[model samples]
Target: MVDSESVKSSYPKSITTSAQDDRGSMEKKQSVQQRVDSFESGEVETVIDKNIEKSALKKMDLVISPIIGFLYLMAFLDRSNIGNASVAGMSDSLKLYNERFNVAISIFYVLYILVETPSVILVKYVRPSRMLAFISLAWSIVVLSSGFVSSYGGLIITRLILGLLEGCLFPALSLYLTTVYSREEQCQRLSYLFCASGLAGAFGGLFAYALEQVHVGNMAGWQWIYIVEGLISFIGVPLSLFLLPDNIEKSWFLNPQERQVARLRNEANLRYLGQQKFDWQEVRKSFKDPKIYVSAVSQFCADMVLYGFSSFLPTIVKDLGFTGLQSNYMTIPVYVSGVLAFLVVAYASDRTKIRSPFLISASLVSAVGYVILIASNSNAAKFTACFIVAIGCYIGPGMNLGWLNNNVAGHYKRATAIGIQQTIANSSGIIAGQIYQSKSAPRYILGHSFTLGCVLVGLIGYIVLLFSLRYANNKRDERCARGMFDPTLTGDYADDFRYFL
Candidate 1:
């Protein structure tokens, strides 16, 4: 076993300790340095017992995953419940005629797209716990205020504010998960987060159906939908502030030994640590990286379907001859299908360590669903097509995110790429709102055909990305074999780094 002094001495004098060292004691520094040296020497498993690492990871799964998942559930609920409200009569109450309601829906994405990149960049500067918690609280207030809106103009303003606040969430949480979990562990954890959208859809439909029966004062059922869901999100604020740790080193739930193991796991996974200062070069690198653009195209196409489908599901169901309450209940099964499908796909992706195949498969599955929806006149067939469409809805976006997060390295670079990817992808929400306008309802041939085309486009993008990443990896391997690689290169640029294909 390596002793503490020798372990501390092994690190070069030029290698600076983390910023946390200033606040931590000498003993803490020694412990951390010892683990770092062990990782560098490829003896980390010997230094930190495997059981301890497993315990630490299991603990993170228990604490972090559920809290973030619940927050995302609320976020998705508030965002998509507008669809339920429209069906529940917010449109008539607020005099939303013709394309007015579509404008209200599209307006949210304008701010959402503008703020995603900046909000993710801020996650490095801000404590994630504080940032996420504060954003959740702020959006909850916006959601609550939405319940009281007396006019379309009032609703628009509330949606704008909600967009700005909620924009920070997905990217921030994605980045935060990267900080805590290894690359191999990421997809399953992210599925939990992404699956929350499906759960929110399920719960929102159930809630909307139940709330529609309420006769509280003069408040409509649509108003109660927003009020009740908004109030539930307030629970996340305290949960985040108290239970969520800023990073592995600062984790309140782990013991001293488990913290060391967690740090070692992060190092083994090639995750950048303690280097939170923003770098302009990394930001520039993200823009120049061809993979970001490819991933953006894929994400954009997937989100177009995601936003269009989720936002208008109730309307789609209602057009099938169901009453408002029946439409709300019918949406529950569709969302549950998405949640289950995503969980299975995510597990298989993680186990196989292959993302592109699953992503390609998802696009194909959803495309077939859209084809059925567009051609079928039978309501039963159309409803079955809804289930088929949902199977790949969460899988494509969830795996796309995990793929990007897996490939990118360095904190700021990854943050920038995620922001860029999400920004471009989320703009699809604008198109989603317009294409599914009231004029296109009943059959919604325009919307279904458009979404079908998106799925195919996204499929082609993923295939291109797969070949490009494979080519890049081969080039890197050739350079390493010839000893032409730079020893000083780190992060994803390192000669030893191989993209997960």
Candidate 2:
């Protein structure tokens, strides 16, 4: 919601006159028509009081957050459900030889990388309401199809299609939310959304366990898990359509003045990014931008390690001499601990408005945890170490993603960045799957080493981020002395435009 009564400042009147004269002296006659004056009240303020709004833009988040969350939770749950089923004897039941299950999980990332950018752009063009709803239904259908897959080829087909549908999800949700909230509010929204993944991880085990109790008519527990989760995803289609407001200003519930403020703010962002259409410029610019690349590559490595461990942990637990039921139950504490870490990181990032430090610390902690795992043989010790690894890795990508969002200039660039980030980062999925094949079960020597390497990449990426921040801050100082906009800046403060550490 926008605050209508906020005061706007542009230095003092004399300074504004001097700046105008200086601009004229530079032959840069940047004058606007009289119509521009309609929104340009000299007394307009920067602060938008949160108490003044009564729009669904205000109420919509509560409804949309859980809906989008539920959709993705199920998407990810079904994608990784094979993890649960692996221990439940999906391998034996289907006679999948030579760790094809790992390969199937890796294949999802291929489609994930391919479809992500286009899907997000589609969301921006077509509107999130329809875009997310359609994707929800599609992924639900794909997830449901997994239940009937009896052969490895069938499972692979389902995973590929599931990836294609699910790829659109997070980036679309991100672009949709950016239209409604300021950057400061974006992080809390992101955290709440990301916490759903933790919930999915925690609850997927429970869902599988509950379904195991059913064993209805010829279906296995894993099949029931996918079917139930898929059905739950379908429920979001209606919810998203009714909720998620289309184009913030069009919502009549917003006061005219509030609408004016929002429109101006959005226009400013669009100008900064320089497009009313899809901008391929961002792709080239992103390569030059240190934060974008660092965050993407580092996050890729993080996901590689995180997905590797999580996607295979249940099977690994079963191999570690735990029963299928015990393995399912054992995942609860690890995932719950991860949920705590996600919440903690979200709150801390929102409070401090910092990212790389948290990212770096978490990466180092994960490295230590993986190191501990390789050294220890005790089951309790191993569980604790893995729990630490989960906390370290699970909380990272959100902060990194949020960091990129805050720094990138517009909805399109931000959207494109997410696509690239998720795509590049997801390439690690292949490496992750190969690292933890069945041959390495019980004491997965190669898998632990791969995690250690990923943790190192994350740590190095953080270092690069620190240096990038230092360089950018110096450029800001130079801009301040020259009295020119840095061109890269947005939001209300210098620090606000910074990376999310």
Off by over 4 Å in 2: 1-45, 53-60, 215-221, 251-275, 287-290, 315-322, 484-501
lDDT of each: 0.82, 0.68
Q: Candidate 2: what lDDT?
A: 0.68
lDDT of 1: 0.82
- lDDT per residue for candidate 1 within 404-443, as digits (tens), equals 9988888899999999999999999889988887666678
lDDT of 2 by residue, 76-100 (tens): 7777777766655677777777767
What 10-residue stretch in candidate 1 is worst by lDDT? 5-14
Cα lDDT, model 1, residue 234: 96
